[model samples]
Target: MHRQSVAARARQALQSKPRASQHRKTRGRVALSNNHRAFRHELHYITRGGGRPVILVHGIAASHSEWGHLIPDLAACGYHVYAPDLPGHGNSPKPGDAQYYQVESLLVQLETWIESLNLQEPPLLIGHSLGGYLGLAYARDHSGEVRGLVLINPLYSPRQLSPVLNLMRKRPQLGEKALRATPKWVIQALVHLDPSAATQFSPQIRQQIAADYKRASPNIVYLTQSLPDMTASLPLVKAPTLVIWGEKDLSLNPASFPELVKLLPNAAGCPIAGCGHQPHLCKHQEVNRLVLEFMNSAAVAR
Candidate 1:
């Protein structure tokens, strides 16, 4: 009997070993294939709660795991949350095609995935960094598709990007080569240096980010090349928006906050003092509160 019990324990550990964390929810993975390149892989995501839908889009080089702190509460609060890893990030299958990294292709594929869900209502979109940029584009294209928007340190102007990204944008070939050459230990060491985690690093989260960063494809550097001028598109994004920023963000300049807010006609700006680029990570409770308040507003009610 003792031997049998030991065998059972070993099997259980094997089953749980693949999961990144114990986020309370049912998770799923949808496969996406780039027809041109013939590369395909699962698009991993978590869906939970029961009332209105809310979709959380994480930034580049990160995964749905970054949304860990925010998910349980949002799920408990009656929101049917959907958090998916972008095509190449997180647990999603990293396609080999460089074109798959293009903003337009990604946006189209993202829309296709959302449409397949056949949501009960237009979702409330909350996006961070590169995800925020994609969210803005989504709102602009389908103004009536989303009830509200929450942007966290979004990538708007290329000028506001972190030094690393700028180098990638300007020197594409070198950037890809360098990214490929970066050792895991170097990335793990650098993860702690991000101002976003200056307050304290959640060991599991920090490790996960570092691992994902190291595993991310060199092709993803291509995303840095094409940033659309949001000046024309911002006005078209009629959905109610809440722009959240971290005063201490090292990745994107905080100065772009006002500029972004000024452009979104129905948007409001929320700047957290001493916060970093990922507000959800730095000030999750505050981020949740603000999102709840916004979702309950009259504009979003309709």
Candidate 2:
């Protein structure tokens, strides 16, 4: 009876071992191939159609979720929307050095990603805030690869944000310490200053965004260090560009858009009603309609 019981126990252990191994293999496969996989793997993105590629780039300290409401709406409108979290902001891996977060370095990664995906003839680049700057840079670096440009309250001449941005850059260690020490509630309180920011985001999203901002603050400071000189880069962006600005944006003044439009070789400025800096989030339907209309008009002309 003792031997029989021992044998039974041994068999159960053997079975459990293989089961565990098989379970691990299954999980590994899922992790490796998940649509949202990040890092050395192609930057994770979602696609819904087989049409012209529309790439959405989020601004500083934001993730793909910034474009969450906008992505599906655009995809439903028959666009192949590609929205990925820039490095360190979302699930993507961060480099050991913050210098990698600089605009020049980020642009290199963007180009590599375009080639990695083998985008055919320049994607329709739509960027918000800092992303607008990156999109402009991408169009400049790879002129023919871009079909058109859409700027959503983008950081054009950096002069507007220099005081805060320069302070962080000049004192990275102090800024990093202060950011790390900030309480989650404090971050949320700060966000509440945006007229409709809290209403637009769910509780869970607000927490996650606060965490993201704190984690990526150092990298964001580095990225915006040279933003004041960004205006000179505008002339290189010759694509048919559309600039959208919210009339009551506290984060970015509306006056900047008119000057930005004049700087671009071919650009149109549009004002969004009752919206703040994030029209895409606060006024999604209107934003989508305008973007679709602009894209459709450009498509017809081509």
- TM-score for all models, in order of appearance: 0.85, 0.79
49-89, model 1: which lDDT tens digit per residue? Answer: 88899989888888888888888988988889899988888
C-alpha lDDT of candidate 1 relative to the true structure: 0.76
As a whole number from 0 to 100, the lDDT of residue 126 in candidate 1 is 88
RMSD values for the candidates in order, in angstroms, are: 12.1, 14.4
Instruction: Report model 2's TM-score to 2 decimal places.
Output: 0.79
Clashing pairs in 1: none
CA lDDT of 254 in candidate 1? 88
- Relative to the true structure, candidate 1 has a C-alpha RMSD (angstroms) of 12.1
Which consecutive 10 residues in model 1 have the weakest lDDT in total?
A: 17-26
lDDT of 2 by residue, 1-302 (tens): 23323223322332331121112211101121212222133344545555778889988888777787778877887777777767657666655555455565555455545555545555899999888888887776656668999999887665655455556756666666676688878986777666767676567656766876866645555666644366877887778999998877776667888889999988999998777778887778788888888998944237
Specify the highest-TM-score model's number: 1
* Candidate 1 wrongly placed segments (more than 4 Å): 1-27, 32-41
